[model samples]
Target: MSTLLLGVNGQVGHELRRALAVHGALLAPPRTRLDLTDLAAVDDFLHQHQPDTIVNAAAYTAVDKAESETALARRLNTELPDLLARYSADHEAVLVHYSSDYVYPGDGDQPWHEDSPTGPLSIYGQSKLDGDEAIARRGCSHLIFRTSWVYSARGSNFLKTMLRLGGERDSLAIVADQVGAPTPARLIADASVHALRRYREAAELGGLYHLAPRGVTSWHGFACEIFRQARHAGMALAIAPERVSAIASDDYPTPATRPLNSRLELSRLENAFALELPDWQSQLSLTLHDLLP
Candidate 1:
């Protein structure tokens, strides 16, 4: 079987390149060759390659910047996925796509389920929701994994940002109001492979699932843990864990609004695939080891 993986350079895509390679022959094209934004080019390539499975890991992730660049964000987050979904349906191929936790309303403290009602607060979230809806409407064999607080050793994510600021500054303030599991990209990739295997065995296994590591933490708490792990890993940091202060979301205003509640329940995913996800701290520590010396 041949699999086409998009966004190969991204945090999750980078790890997926390794995880998906074991399953079958994989085709991961860089943006220069397979630009998702160019519909005609992407359609032409898909028609020519005709992959059995297409894993779309690419997304418009600039949450704050997306508020201003609405057109670009919509094209990437909504239109592109719609096109891919149609292509998957036409080719009778399995479509595996990544989504965000921002689809849920940011009000409640309860963990969001796959069937939870969605009320996106920002344009980025709305676009993602639209994409998810469009994919479902297309009636293709697809697996949509809604994950949150994703970080990796290689990417410019929250973990790396904290590590950089920790080394340069004596003190830092993180938004404690925002809560979610700090999911590792490696874990997501592994879970995707597991889900793919199950889907191949039973086509009914393809659907929306909340895939996140167990346990939860506020942004401030996550930042504190990062410093602790980095310090234990013999990495130098100017700011101590105790020096990091927790602040409200209002304290740090941005162009786009973020969901205070990003926690996602993973029982549906675990039960379906018979997989036990590790705790967020454990995954974070492992990633820190890779990021540090």
Candidate 2:
């Protein structure tokens, strides 16, 4: 099967490039060559290439910046997916898309289910939700994985930011109210490959599923764990674990209102695919090993 992976340079896409390659011939075009924002060009490329599987991992991920740059966010997060869904429906190809847990209302403590009522708090979240809806409305064979707090050793994410701050600063403050799993990009890539295999074997497996590592923690808790793992990995840090203060979301204000509850239920994913996802801490430790020198 010919597989076309977009956003190969992104956190999740980078790992997907390797994982998806083993399944089939992978065509991961650079942004300079394939501009997903340009609908005409993307449509032409899809028609010309006619890839059997299209994995869209590209997204405008700047949560705060998205408030001001709504158009750009919509183009990437909403319009691009709509275009891809249309193409997938026309060509009868499978489209694998990644979504965020931010689509749910952030007020609750309960883990979001696949059928949870969505009430996006920020522009970024709304755009992602719109993209998910567009894909579903297209009536195409697709798999939408709603994940949360994604990070990787290679990208600019929370883990990397904390590592840098810990080494340079004497103290740091992290929000403690927000809670979610810090899912590693590697896990997402691996799960995507596994799900793709299942879909190939049985077409009925194509649908929305939450694909995050097990367990949950606050932002402060996640940061503390990152430092703990970094120190265990022999990485030097100026700031001690206790030096990181746990602050409320109000203390660190951003343009976009963040979701306090990002926990997503994974029983659907586990039972459907017969796969066991590791805990958040286990995956975070592995990623820290990769990240630390």
Q: Quick one: best lDDT, which candidate? A: 2
After superposition, candidate 1 runs with Cα above 4 Å error: none
Q: Candidate 1 on 122-222: residue-level lDDT in tens?
A: 99999999999999999999999999988998879999999899999999989999999999999999999889999899998889999999999999999
Q: What is the lDDT of residue 16 in candidate 1?
A: 97
Off by over 4 Å in 2: none
TM-score of 1: 0.98
* Overall lDDT per candidate, in order of appearance: 0.92, 0.94
lDDT assessment of candidate 2? 0.94
TM-score of each: 0.98, 0.99
lDDT for 5 in candidate 1 is 95
